[model samples]
Target: MKVKVKVVLKDGILDPQGKAVLHAINDLKFKGVGDVRIGKYIELTFDSLDQSLVENETKEICQKLLANPVIENFDYEIEELT
Candidate 1:
């Protein structure tokens, strides 16, 4: 199975990196760009074919290592690889 995970800062959390990018966007004269939030995208290949197992493992991986449970949120999708 192939898993794709996304880790992002929770709402109400301050993101300085995102703010810097937003500032740069404004400097470049791009109008109407209100917010820019940065996040992490991870791709993992699992040996298990069972979707449920993969899902559980992915969530555990995100919570234990990939994301800061207090300040960040994570979500993942599992796909069967041919």
Candidate 2:
């Protein structure tokens, strides 16, 4: 089984990195670029094929370490590999 996690800052949170990127984009003469946001993408492979177990563990992993409940949010997708 494989799990892919994406962690991103919550709405209304200030993203300094994103802002910097946006400013650079504007300076580069890129028009119509309104905003920019950055996030994390993680991939995990599990030996077990149990969907329930994978879901539970992935949820716990994201909640505990992958995402900050205060200013960040996370979501994941599970894929079974044969």
Candidate 3:
């Protein structure tokens, strides 16, 4: 099984890194770029074929290890491969 986790800042949270990137984009002559938020993606592979179990475990991993859950939100998807 393969799990992909995405962690992103919650709405209304300040993202300095995203702001800097946005400024750089405008400086590079890119227009119409609005608010941008940065996030993280993590991929994990396992031998199990259970999608439900993998999703549950992946959520746990995000809550315990991957994401802070304070100012950030996380979601995950599980893929079973033969």
Candidate 4:
């Protein structure tokens, strides 16, 4: 089983890194670009096929170590590849 986790800032949160990238993009002559936000992607692989257990464990991982729930939001997907 493979799990993919995405952690990103909430809609109302200001992202300085994203802003810097946006500025660079403008400086590079890209037009019509509005706001930019940055996020993280984490991939996990396991030998179990139990989706419920995986989801629970993944949520625990997020709450404990993966993301700061106060300012960031996270979601995950599980896939079984045999």
Candidate 5:
């Protein structure tokens, strides 16, 4: 099984890195950009094909280690590789 986790800043939180990237993009003449936010992407491969267990473990990992509960929120998806 393949798993993907995305961690992003909560709404109303400032994102300096995303802002900096946006400013740089604008400086290079990119247009129609409104806003940007930065976050983390995590990929995991599990040998088992049990989607429910994988999902539960992934959620636990996100809450315990992958994402900061205070400032960030996380979501995950699971896919069968083969």
Candidate 6:
């Protein structure tokens, strides 16, 4: 099984890194760039092929360490690999 996790800052939260990325893009003459929100992407390999169990564990991992529930939110997808 494989799980993909994406962690991003919640709405109304200030993201200096995202802002910096936007500014840099504009400075480089890239036009029409809208609000940029930076996030973290993580991949995990699991021994079980059970989708439900893997998703549950992934959520737990995110809540405990991968993300800050107070200021950040996360979503994950689980896939079984043969």
> Could you say which candidate leads in lDDT?
2
| Candidate 5 global TM-score | 0.94
Score candidate 4 by lDDT: 0.93
How do the predictions measure up, each by TM-score?
A: 0.92, 0.92, 0.91, 0.90, 0.94, 0.91
Give a tens-digit lDDT track for model 1, residues 38-72: 99999999988988888888888998999999999
> Which 10 consecutive residues of model 3 have the lowest summed lDDT?
46-55
Which segments of model 3 are wrong by more than 4 Å? none
Tell me the tens digit of each residue's lDDT in model 5 across 1-82. 9999999999989999999999998998989888989999999898989889998899999999999999999998898897
Between prediction 3 and prediction 6, which has the larger lDDT?
6
Task: Report each candidate's C-alpha RMSD, comma-separated, in the order given.
Answer: 1.0, 1.0, 1.1, 1.1, 0.8, 1.1
- Candidate 3 per-residue lDDT over residues 1-82, each given as its tens digit: 8888899999999999999999999999988999789999999997877777777788888999899988999988777776
- Model 2: lDDT equals 0.95
Q: What is the number of backbone collisions in each predicted candidate, taken in the order shown?
A: 0, 0, 0, 0, 0, 0
Q: How well is each residue in 25-80 modelled by candidate 6, as lDDT tens digits?
A: 99999899988999999999999877788888898999999999999999988866
Q: Which residue runs of candidate 5 sit more than 4 Å off their true CA positions?
A: none
Which residue runs of candidate 1 sit more than 4 Å off their true CA positions?
A: none
Error of 1 at 33 (Å): 0.9
Better of 1 and 6 by TM-score: 1
- Candidates 1 and 2, the one with greater lDDT: 2
**Model 5 pairs whose backbones collide:** none
